[model samples]
Target: MTQIIRTSADLRDRVAAWKRSGILVGVVPTMGALHDGHMSLVREARKQSDRVIVTIFVNPMQFNNASDLDKYPRDEAHDLAMLEAEGVDVLFAPGVNEVYPDGFATKVSVSGISEPLEGAFRPGHFDGVATVVSKLFGMTQAGRAFFGEKDWQQLQVVRRLVEDLNIPIRIIGCPTIREPDGLAMSSRNVRLSEAERAQAPALHRIMTAAAEQIRAGAPIETALEQAKAEILAAGFHDIEYLEVRSVEGLRPMETFSEPGRMLVAAYLGDVRLIDNIAV
Candidate 1:
């Protein structure tokens, strides 16, 4: 059985015991509504560390839209079953007050890399992520943290935050897990209508096709524009951004580069889908 530990104090005590045992700890921070994508991170943590802790607290500060936050899926019973099946050692499901007490004033914000894409589209989203993640690291006192690359930018932000602040934790990035149809798995995907669900995989298809084209010497802007048009045609109405950017620093790329990735964020019905592929 996986132990469910809440409250930072209880977490500190358990982590202290592990510290005494001299075992390496890995933390997988998630928003609950556990999916195979999140399990993939737990799997990686299990392999890489002696002990694993998965945090399930959908931090309210991370959601820019109140409704989106309100609608974010959560089922602790189901999540715990999945974590137990995965052999996770502990599941830290903290309450809002446990994680964010009254008069929580500090906010962690990363500049430069966080400015474009999701940051620009969802104002202050990364700040919320950074702050909560920082708190998670402190609470778990884990030596390594695992995050999936499905959220490429968010992964980068966490990496930057850990390094900039000298948090003394190793950040391990796991590859993105996707459906057989190629749609990146996300909690929000469940909200898509049946028709929208059918069209969702096209986002991944477009990024892959665009990546190949760019690699084959096609003009970056031309490939991206064509991808944007195709996404709209595929029934994604709000094509927020479709860009090819450097893997590091996330600088926009207009030409072939060794470490570049093609990223897209579009909406199907009301569900927002984001997918990225290496270029």
Candidate 2:
């Protein structure tokens, strides 16, 4: 039976017992509304470690829009049931006050790579990401942590945090799990209206095609400009960015001499979708 832990002391006690027994631990951090994409991480953790801890906290600090934060999907009972089926050892579902209580004053900020992309569009986003993630690292204290590559830039930011802060856990990035039509799986996808959902796969489709053309010798700027046009034509509004960038720093790339990535974020009606592909 999977254990449901809601307090840091209870979690640390369980972790201590696992430590004493020399069992390796892996943790998957999530904001609930469990889906197959989140399960993929749990499965990977199960495969690699003796114990798996799945955290279900919708970190309020990360949302740029207060309404967006309020609307973020959360179904903990469903999430817990899914984890139980996956053989997760513990479900760390802490209250917001537990994670960020009164007198909480510290924030973790990673400069440079985080300043662009999502950071540029969603101000203070990565600071929230870095802060809560750093706290997760401390709270779970697992030997390994799993993150999905769908949030490619976020992965780099976490990796930088682990290295720069000398955090002991190994950050393992799993390949993005996508829907049959290629829409990247996200908790927010649940809010997409049916019409928006049908049109959502185009984001991935366009990015994939753009990456192929760029790889096949198309000019980088031209490929990106065409992608923006395609997204706009597809009825996406508030198109935040569509550019090819160096995978490491997210710096825009004009020449595709080395491996690079094409990242995009646009709104399909009210739902914002982001996707990336290799070039």
Candidate 3:
């Protein structure tokens, strides 16, 4: 059974006791639509630490669109069952007021790396991510934190946050978990229509193919342009971006002289899907 701690003060006390006993803590932060992708992170946390705390708060601060926030999936009972099966120590599912209480005026912002890709398409998104993630770090006081590499840019922003702010926690990035057909698992996947769901896997399939081309010395722009056209033709409604960038700084890569990543954001109807691959 997992202990459900709904407030920061309670979580701190629990963490304090764990630390007093010299138990290493690990945390997996998420919004509550638990799927295999999220479970993979929990399993890693469990293996790497003495205790694990999985936080599930749909942070409203991160949403640029009010309707998108409202539509975000959440199921506490189902999520709890999954956490229990994973033997998670705590489910830090706090309310909005609990995380951002009255008079809470602070915000955590990481610039540069956060200004492109998802950040450009979704404004003020990473600020909410940084703010909530920093608060979670402080609240959990865990020695290690696990994040999925599916959100590669997000992993970078968080790594930068911990380094710049000197927060004492190790950030571990696990590989992106995908379905057999190759669609990356996401909470938003639930919103896709039956037809859209079938078309969604093409994002990964096409991105992977483009990445291989870039590696084989195809002109970066030509490869990306073809990928975008193919994705739109493959039944996607629109493409936000299909770009090759440096894995470190996320700077646009023209020649692929260094290690790069192929990242794409395409829409299958109103549900925008994002995926990335190594190049």
Candidate 4:
């Protein structure tokens, strides 16, 4: 059976002990809603490390709206059972009080790149993400960390964080897991109603259409404008952003380039969904 650890101090001591023995540690950070998407990360970690430590904490700092934070899913018993089945080695689950003992007065912030796209929509989301991820890397002392490309911007921010701070951890990005209809799997996906769920695939369709346009030598602006129009016409309430960025720099593109990313976010009712594709 995998060890279930619920306190920070115990996780610290156990990881520290593993470090002295020179064992490879892998960390997978997540909130406590275990899905197949999350299991992909856990399995990847288990394959690569001598021990895998998965941290399940719903981070309050990441949510700008109180309702969104309050409504975020929680199924601790199910989450633990899923992790144990995936051959997870250790689970580092800490309470909000345990994670932010000082009440989150300190935070991590990345400049420039974060202000565009999703960051523009949710003010301090990345700051919360960066802070919590930094703490996870420290607590686990992981040699490698796993993330999904579904949150491509987040993966980029974390990659930059590790590089800039000289944190000795390798980031392994797994491919985005998707529903059969192509909607990327997310904890937030549960919020969609049957009708809303039917419309959810529009986000993925938009990006796939953009990729085809880019492949056909269309201009970047033309592709984005067409995709935005299609999404709005399909009845999505608000289009937050549709950006084609250099995969390396995450900057707005003047022209479409192969091996780039097309990122889109839209609101259906009040639930926001993001999807991206490589072109």
**Model 2 Cα shift for residue 80 (angstroms):** 1.3
In candidate 2, residue 182 scores what lDDT?
93
What CA RMSD would candidate 2 show?
0.9
Better of 2 and 3 by TM-score: 3
Count of steric clashes across candidates, in order: 0, 0, 0, 0
Report the lDDT tens digits of candidate 3 across residue range 1-279: 899999999998999999999999999999989899999999999999999999999999999999989999889999999999989999999999999999999999999999999999999999999999999999999999999998999999999999999999999999999999999999999999999899999889888888888889899999998988889899996688889999989998899899999888888988978888899
lDDT of 2 by residue, 91-147 (tens): 999999999889999999999999988999999999999999999989888999999
TM-score preference between candidates 1 and 4, better one: 1
- Angstrom error of the Cα, residue 207, model 3: value is 0.8
User: Which stretches of candidate 3 lie above 4 Å from their native place?
Assistant: none
Candidate 2 displacement at residue 73 in angstroms:
0.6
Off by over 4 Å in 2: none
Higher-TM-score candidate among 3 and 4?
Answer: 3
On lDDT, the stronger of 2 and 3 is 3
Q: TM-score of every model?
A: 0.98, 0.98, 0.99, 0.96
lDDT scores for all predictions?
0.92, 0.90, 0.93, 0.89
Once fitted onto the true fold, the runs of candidate 4 whose alpha carbons sit more than 4 angstroms away are: none
**Model number with the top lDDT:** 3
Over 89-120, each residue of candidate 4 has an lDDT whose tens digit, in order, gives: 89888988889987458778887777788899
